[model samples]
Target: MAPRQKTAGLLDAVGPAFSRLRRSVLLDVENPVPAKDLTRTLVLNIVEDGADGEVTVGVVAERLAVDPSVASRMVTDCIGAGYLVRAASQRDGRRTVLRLSPEGAATLERFRQHQRVAFEYITRDWPEQERLEFARLLLKYVDAIDALRAPA
Candidate 1:
C-alpha cells in the first residue's frame, strides 16, 4: 500500500479503538456528576489545575479544542451543579478563575480509580515492561499531537 493509504488506515482504526477504550475504561460506570465526557473532562481539568490557583474557561476551551462559548456554558453548568466555583484570579483580580468544588474532587477521584482498575484489568496479561512502554508511547503520541496544536 502507498504510505498515504497506510496512514489513512491507521487513523481510521484509531477511532474505533478509542471508542472501545472509552466505553471500557472511562464511561460505562456510574458517576456522581452524571456528566458527558466533555463536561467530565472540563471538571477534571479544573480540578487538576486548581492547585496552581484557578484555571480560566478560555484555557480549558483551548486545551479541549472547543469554542470558548461552549467552554463557558460547560463551566456555568458545572457551577450550577455544584461541581465548580468561579472566583476572581488572585494574580489578576479582573480575570475570572475556575476551581473545582469538593464534590467535584471526589468525583474526579472516583473516575481516576475507575481508570486505574480498567487499565489493570486490561493489562493483566501483559508483561510489565510492555505495559510501561505502551504507556510511554501513548503519552508521547498525545504530546506530539499537542505540540502540533500549539501556537508556533
Candidate 2:
C-alpha cells in the first residue's frame, strides 16, 4: 500500500478508537469518582488551568465552544456539584468569575490519578520506551489541536 493510503487507514481507525474511549469512560461504573462526567472535568480544568484574571461563564462558553446558555447551565451544574464556585471578579466586584473549590481541586487530582492508573493498566504490556513515546505523541497531538483552535 502507498504511504498516503496507510495514513488514511490510520485516520479511519482513529475515529472509532476515539468513540470507544468516550464510551469506556461513560461506562466506567467501577470507579467511585463523582466527577466522572466529561463536562465536569472540562469545567474544572478551565477554572483551574485556564484562569486568566477572571474566568466567567462567557469564558467557559467560548473555551468550551458552547453557547452562552449552555455554558451557564454547565457551570451551574459544576457549582451545584461543589466543584466550582461563583465569586466576585477581582477587576470588578460586581462581575462574577469561576473558581475551583477545594473539593474541585481534590476531585480533579483524583480523576487525573484515575486516568493515570487506567493508562498504566491498559499499556502495561508495552515496552517502556514505546509507552513513553506514545504518551508524548498523544500530548503533542492535543497541544497542536489546541494551538490550531486558538484565535490568531
Best by TM-score: 2
| Candidate 2 lDDT over residue span 46-140, tens digit each | 88866565899998998889999999999999899898988899889999999988998988898788788778877889999999999999999
What does the lDDT come to for candidate 2? 0.84
Question: Candidate 2 — worst ten consecutive residues by lDDT sum?
Answer: 26-35
Q: Provide the TM-score for each candidate, comma-separated.
A: 0.71, 0.85
Off by over 4 Å in 1: 1-12, 23-25, 29-38, 50-54, 146-152
Q: How many clashes does each candidate structure show, in the order listed?
A: 0, 0
Shift of residue 119 alpha carbon in model 2, Å: 0.6
Model 2 Cα shift for residue 33 (angstroms)? 3.2
Sequence-dependent TM-score of model 1: 0.71
| Residue-level lDDT for 5 in candidate 2 | 100
